[model samples]
Target: MAGVHVVANQKGGVGKTTVTVNLAAVVADTLGGTADSSPVLGVSTDPQASMLEWAERAGNELPFDFEQCHDNPKLLGKLREIKQYSHIFVDTPGSLENESILQAVLTQADDVIVPLEPEPLSFNPATRSIERVIQPAGVPWRVLLNNWDPRDGTADLEQTREYIAAKRWPAFNTVIRHYKLHTRAPADGVTVVQYAKNRVALEARQDFFRLALEVLGTGGDGPRHASAVNGVSSTNGG
Candidate 1:
């Protein structure tokens, strides 16, 4: 069985699909996946199927296996039965109308990653999803600050951190900073690892690499997986 990590939030435009693909890609790279064997799998439960489309656009260049399981409860429920992949990252729908799909995925999730923007308006919807769906599922979850721009100063970032801390929510220390590269990735059919080798591209890829380490329990404070990779046993809890 693979560790199922669902990237979910009830609000739109929080970079759920972006985080799902990139995180899976970097983790697969760290695991040294080859052309014939991909250790990571990316699944999309959004009716929009953004992740699936991104994989299609990427052609055969994606580092991990990809699947679209939207409206398919049977597939979502059977995720744990698949043993080939070490990790499975799921991109879920952000709309309330498709919440049942989110619920179905959560039932099999070993961990959940909630992406939240640094804005007051996003707080309520993020909290609603955490409290309503995630909490009930009893899965370990952490909030990730996405689309943060250092140029805009740290006021918004600081305030968002304060909000999460006030609510006693677990969060990642890593912030997925805003970058035009990430915005253009879907249309360009590229992941951070596939970006042109430049300063900005290196920075973009590094962020996800650090995030992947945290998810694998090799770095930072985040949930650990039961599996071993590269002789490292990620067995500790966050």
Candidate 2:
């Protein structure tokens, strides 16, 4: 079914808007094309309007410009008016405690995607937001490790998983690494597909496509439940 998907966090600088803007562009580019002709709704609740800015940069490709909900509370109503769209992607402000923003999005969302950096510091806000805001709404959540540099074993992936284990949060298995393509996505106004053609960028593109499928109940990559050590394969039985 068509419903809202909120990209949120209680902290800042965790690539929240980056994820939202890129995912919207990705979905629009993938499904909203002439073949599917599905309308993908973009809702920008962040006062900064970073996602909205990215949509403007994206130009004519967007089925509709990102709708700015200045009142925040009016989001529910604003969303009600957009019937043509088969999916709604929303971006909320960082470190925000506005009930209306949460209420507006959660009250109607089909699912939620929380984009978090692979650091305990990042998880602090993200985890809390999920516990306090998201769970109460009773919607599904996909915890994305965004801007993650898994190579830094001690500081990044290992510690990240350590934090996830302690909290026992179910996170997405497929991740988009901290590649330049993600940062450059908005400036170039191109989806990763239209931008770089390297292994990393291509992998990220697939991860998001699978993400879209999961959201639409079409399923994604097989469950990501792997055992590792320092972010490496240290579970050898040999």
Candidate 3:
């Protein structure tokens, strides 16, 4: 059966939809090759149907197969039975008001990607969601550091890492820095793999590809422990 990956977080604006769209493109770029069709399927369960809207704008240019299953988590079972793709990515709701739908998706997912913003306001809600919702469901999850800024040294990054470390949450080493291309991607109705032809876009492409590898447990060391710094695991577990 194809693996179901859910991009989730209870907090809004953490880039869950962005991660879902780009990562789907990354998977399609690799799995689909130059044949012009992808084995990856992008599913959207968000009430707003953001991924569907993006696909509509992208029209026939989207790399992977796209579908809208808004508020319908059961479609996952049927999709798995079809086994038509190398992997499936589901974009989920970011607000607590949609907790039931989010929980339903998480319960059916093979893995979860929690996009965490490196800031004060995001810490508690992300931690709570991971602990109360994800952990209890026994779903394997990794937190992707989104909107990271590495210019002024590693102080803020280190602090956020420490907080995650204290909670003992698993995370990826690839940090997604804020970029104009990422901000412009959704509005442009394209993903980095298709639209990232320039400097920042190229860098963003590499970031998501690295993230895709990590999620597949083929990025050298797999998902690292929260104490991992520069891909070197500081703790015993990974």
Candidate 4:
């Protein structure tokens, strides 16, 4: 089977869209060359459509094009019907109530990446979202830390880590540093690969590649049963 990875969190401004778009680009680069690579299909479900906008600004020349699914109740069924593509990346809305669309996607999804800001508020939503949608629908997920600053040991990083540890949740070990480059990332409308080789973007790219490997799984035959979508999917094949 094919994989569907949702970049979402109940809370807003956790860099959901940024992660979605860039992650898609990284996946493309990692697996795009070989015909056997599992292709990634990026779906923009958020009302704001930040990922969609980035796709537009980056021009239609990307390895994979981002599709706007409109968050209709029919979304999941619509996606599953097309199995030619290999993977799916969905950028969901920020509000918790958006579960209607999120849950529908998750029902068919294999995994999700919940971006947390290393704070209690960011930490809280993963559990709630899982309880409400992930567990209910039987989907797997990983919490990814974003905008991390180790300086705030007492309030941000440590607290969130302990909370996640207590809950026994899966989280990415790579931490995205808080940098002006990352803040300006979306405006540039490209993944770290497309940017200048600064230290910050370089690290971000490596971390994202780690996430891509996690998505693609070990030994990279790349997820089985690639989706039936129209184009060559964006994949992170080994």
Candidate 5:
């Protein structure tokens, strides 16, 4: 069976869909997937169907398979049964009211990637989702620092890391910096790998490539001692 990775967070606007699609794309590319036979699959359980829309906009250019299974717990739970794909990346609903949808996908998650913006307000809800939903599921999960701007210096980034450490939460060493290319991706129907070959685009794709290596267990040291808190070992990546 394929490894099922669900990108989830209870709070909205954390780049869950962006993480799902791009991570899947980079992993698929790394694995040498083709349009005809993709090793990766991207599934969206969000009512907004953002992933599906993005895929449609990209037309036949996406490197992996894509699907939207909104409000369908049975389909979501059965994803692990699919054997063709090496990995299945799921984009889930963002609101607490969609707890049922989130719960359904978590049932199949081998690992969960929770994208967190480095801001004070995003802290509580992220912790809430981890404590109430992800931790209870007992899956090895990590908090990914997304949308961080290095131009703003490392204070906010360092503070976010401190918060995660104080709570003993697992996290990726890979911080996905803020890039206008990422914001323009969905509208342009492109993934990081499909971005124009410019320095900025290269940097954008490199982040996800490093992240994909980590997710595939081929990069970086594993996450901090998060096993002590959740009793599940966390994996690290570059």
Candidate 6:
């Protein structure tokens, strides 16, 4: 059974799609199997279909298999038939009003990655989502501090981290800082690994790489696959 990781949160605008796409890229680019026989599958369950658009924009630039499954709740049942895949990354809806969709995705996911912004407003909803949905599903989860401003040494970042720690939530050590290169990806149809010329781009790439490592470590497995490449096979959601 391939590891199923879902990017979900009750609160919107937390960069769920961004994390979903990039982590899938890192896994497909650097981990298991060859790029030609891509191992990672990017599953988009969000009603907005942002991931679908992103895949179209990326074209051959994407490093993993991409799919849009509007019927996300059925994804879990179908995944069992796809044991060949090494990783499955699902991008889910973030609206509090979309609890049913989030619940469905969570029910099927083996793991969840909750990306939280560095703000007070982002914390409560995430915590509630984790407590009400994630814990009940018994799926292991980790929170990543996204959109962090390293220059702003105010208490926001620290307080948020402390809050997570206080609640005994698992989180990643790699903090994804806000960078222009990251913001430019969706617009430019580029992944961090493809942004080879810019230092900040390379830095962003490294963060995702670290995140991939952390995720893979959860299963105590390494990137054991074919030669690394730069492209992935694209597919539609089932």
Best by TM-score: 5
Could you estimate the TM-score for every candidate?
0.93, 0.80, 0.88, 0.82, 0.94, 0.86
Per-candidate RMSD vs. true structure?
Answer: 4.8, 7.2, 4.0, 7.1, 2.3, 8.2
Answer with 5 or 6, whichever has the higher TM-score.
5
**Candidate 6's residue-wise lDDT over 1-238, tens digit each?**
6778888887888999899988888888876545468888889888889889888899876888888886645664576457768889989887777778777776667667889998999988898888888778766677889988888885899999888767767677878888877778887887776786777777878888887877776432322111111222111121
Backbone clashes in model 5: 2
TM-score of 5: 0.94
Higher-scoring candidate on lDDT, 4 or 6: 6
Model 1 worst lDDT window (10 residues) = 224-233
Give the clash total for candidate 1: 0
Off by over 4 Å in 5: 221-225, 228-238
lDDT of candidate 1 over 36-61, digit per residue (tens): 78999999999988888899999889
* lDDT (10s digit) by residue, model 2, range 40-136: 7678787777776777777765544467774657556566456777667888877565656766777776667778787767766786788888877
Off-target runs (Cα >4 Å) in candidate 2 are 32-38, 63-65, 78-81, 97-99, 151-155, 198-200, 221-238
lDDT of 4: 0.68
Give the Cα-based TM-score of candidate 1 against the true structure. 0.93
Quality of model 2 by C-alpha lDDT: 0.66
- Ordered list by TM-score, greatest first: 5, 1, 3, 6, 4, 2
Q: 150, model 5: CA deviation in Å?
A: 1.5
Could you tell me which 10 consecutive residues in candidate 5 have the lowest summed lDDT?
220-229
Candidate 2 clash pair list: none
Superpose all Cα atoms of candidate 1 onto the true structure and report the RMSD in Å to 1 decimal: 4.8
Clash pairs, candidate 3, are none
